[model samples]
Target: MRHLLVRLATVLAGVTVLAAPTAASVNLDVAGFGPAHHALAGHGVGYNINGYNWGGYAATGSGFTSVSATWTTPSATCNSRSDLYAPWVGLDGYGSSSVEQTGVATDCSSGRAVNEPWYEMYPAAPVYLSTSSYPVAAGNVIHASVTYAGGSSFTLTLTNQSRGWTYTTTKSLSGARRSSAEVIIESPPGRYPNFGTISFTGSTVNGSSLSSFNPVALDPSNGVYEAHTGALSGGNFSITYQHE
Candidate 1:
């Protein structure tokens, strides 16, 4: 009877793994948003790196089922190179590999500011979804959400509330660690775009506010770029670019 019970448990575990949704593989061309610059002095709830500054819960458990945030589009300056910055919410990729995220990229190309909606599953390049169906612009109120659909599937939704436009897509992902949920301002791996001050309001992970978790300041080992995070109050926070 004991051996039969052990075999049954093993079979159940196998069934659970096989039942998980399988994510479609995507080609990732963009550079990974890993550790870059450092956080600015007196900013950020937790963790600071040279290229990324974020605020959120940093724990290892079942991971976050959903993450969402609302932010006003900030002005961007590329200086000389086509610099880039993004405000995003996602699961994992903080202390582990694999990240599932969606947000708006405010880029400075040829001294002009361009904003658009995009989603990414780490190990794959970001996929831009903005077009005539969902247009984005500066000063628009953007709300982005990433919800886990169990297993390797998740749904990403981005809305330009100011323009009354929304873009949503459901994708399956593989190799997701689901370690942490985050609200971040990132200067992707190549050029350091001047992302002007941006405010993020109503930040939530798994239905709970950011203030509910013990936030930490995450910074890169090498201090190159500089950004700051405002205090978390009422689940709202702001991240400002200090230098790039």
Candidate 2:
């Protein structure tokens, strides 16, 4: 069962699709720690690196010795970077991080599945899609935004791949629209910086439809905002963009 769970976790976490090469270098800093408007504590730059999403985090010890950490995938492409981006210390006040995964598709008929990435957070913060519950069902588009009081404005659009599902409006920074994206059951690899899904109906470079689907797992046990935790907190996150 242990091995089975590991496989399940690997499949659910979407670890198989992170083998692509990255387009740029990821840099993580630890000296300039920022404040916590998002609570949870952790901050830094976030983006895709070498086809794998990474987030860096660093925290000062009570007395001395500070701890700096980088959240990344177990793939060779990500683990073997020389200029690997490290986590950094956050500055005072509010801060934010955002990463985008584009060009997603799936060819189910051929039994070939491509990972469709989505941002997710652990500890499950109750999300609402247009005044409804979480997991904005299919056929609805939700406009999502995040702000850190004194921090920057973070926004993204979510389209439900499924139908008749919606998140509540009260959960949105701008109660007017909910996050929208076509939600698929294909769980992509990588970590969830925040909990949620972004639907994609586009074709890949080879002309394949996006069919990855996931039921949306809310992991509350893991609270530290690591790159793979699907939760966003205070941490240094990196992203190396790629197109193939």
Candidate 3:
């Protein structure tokens, strides 16, 4: 399979407005968690907001004041069956420096729902894969891969503790192209702790592809396992649950 790296640009800016002195200034901040960090590995990630607006506006003691805000959505796609490419943990702090709120997501596409298992049904769950039965040793990374099997693509997820994780576009199987959907998980603070095995669950897309999930017991030999959709060659996806 060919690997690719795509960067979604995130922008942050501030603006001022004129309003009554008694009016309060509102601040906003947005953060996305999940597959968005990696999009070339069939992760199908994206970002968005609903039910509310994000960002802040201020008044400068003017007779009339107005405040406006906007955001950019990452380039992404998901099949009802194939995979999901957005943050399950969504966004927060729409109009305040510090507030607690959930992020929003768009529905999946038609083709992906038919072939991929993750989005086959509505309201999909998070897919997890076990890196090892035990905590991965320091300075070590876990790896894996997936291939197109004559049908629509699928979704895959993994967990790790490396600071920077990425995919390559120069490598892949003979006939299939690397997907623009990918995700990278980073390690926690302090020393790398052993997070148990990674597992996967499936969600259906409304009018897209078919998604399936296979549960695997922990692998003891390589401390790594491959997703059923493809194989792990040369350990392409690698990360150690470690700290800087």
On lDDT, the leading prediction is: 1
Worst 10 residues of 2 by lDDT: 26-35
lDDT of 2 at 131: 20
Tens-place lDDT per residue, model 3, 40-102, is 122211211110111011111211111111112222223122122221211111121221111
What residue runs in model 2 are displaced by over 4 Å at the alpha carbon?
Answer: 1-50, 54-138, 150-244
Candidate order by lDDT, decreasing, is 1, 2, 3
Model 1 misplaced regions, further than 4 Å: 1-61, 219-222
Candidates 2 and 3: which is better by lDDT?
A: 2
**lDDT of each candidate versus the true structure:** 0.62, 0.21, 0.18
Counted clashes in each candidate structure: 23, 79, 70
TM-score of each: 0.75, 0.22, 0.19
